[model samples]
Target: MNAKKLQKKIFPLPKQVEVKDGALKLDKVALKITADVHTAKQAAAVLEKKLAALGIGVCDCAKTTITLALGEAPAQVQFAEQGYRIAVTADGVELTGFGAQGVYYAAVSFVQMLDREIPCCEILDWPDMDFRGHVIESRLGSDLMEKEDWFAMID
Candidate 1:
């Protein structure tokens, strides 16, 4: 997959992207989370579920591993509160986030890029605005919103 093509496929487009030759083919993968980072664990679990839906299994050991961690952005780049970097290569995929919210976003982006294979690339992204919200007006509907409706809206 071409980097340009992949970029177009991703919603809200990443701030920075670089692609190299070849792609990483995913079969079974090992998911590793940074110790002490509860958000990383949660992000890994979310990714695992998405992969399972694609018929890819995750386990304790594998040639290909996806790592989730909370860390600083590369020196040249200053990440916002919810910024993240995703690097995919023949070696493996590394998803690093600046915060808990960043970790969740990183997992979401990685999941979006999944297919039979992922293009070898690096993506740096963050929301333009620190605050994002949605307001649902109950007045428009005759019936009260169910719990599932709220969850669905959030998703």
Candidate 2:
């Protein structure tokens, strides 16, 4: 079967991206997730849980690796609340961000990169918009808004 080429389809596109190869499966890699701060630790835990759910093995002692770390990115002043950089190499992968939220976004981006299996690549990214939020407003209508619906929406 033909392999899929890496394409730039990520949301809030990275500032820079370079693809080196087509596919890099996650099965045989040693995954390591680390956090430098409390919030980052929480984010790392979430990432680790997600990885576990995917049935991907994680270990700190392997030659081929996937290192997920949460720490202050170089020149933290440049990245806002949601900025990150991720690099996938022959040896392993490295994800870096400015804060906990940044690290979370990095993890998300890394997952997205694995759509067709991790492509050998490098990326530098940061949020273009300073703030992004949405509101769901409802008013009286033919269909009344149920209390249960409101509770679910809030949740």
lDDT scores in order? 0.82, 0.65
Q: Which numbered prediction scores highest in TM-score against the true structure? A: 1
Question: Model 1: which ten-residue window has the lowest total lDDT?
Answer: 73-82
After the best TM-score superposition of candidate 1, give how far the Cα of residue 129 lies from its true spot, in angstroms. 0.9
Candidate 1 RMSD to the real structure: 6.1
Number of clashes recorded per candidate: 0, 0
Q: On residues 86-146, what C-alpha lDDT tens digit does candidate 1 reach at each position?
A: 9999878998888888888888888888876888999999887778565775536588788
Residues 58-109, candidate 2, lDDT per residue (tens digit)?
6766576766665555563465557777887766788776666777777777
> CA shift at 46, candidate 1, in angstroms?
1.5
Residue 56's C-alpha lDDT in candidate 2? Answer: 69
How well does candidate 1 score on lDDT at residue 88?
A: 93
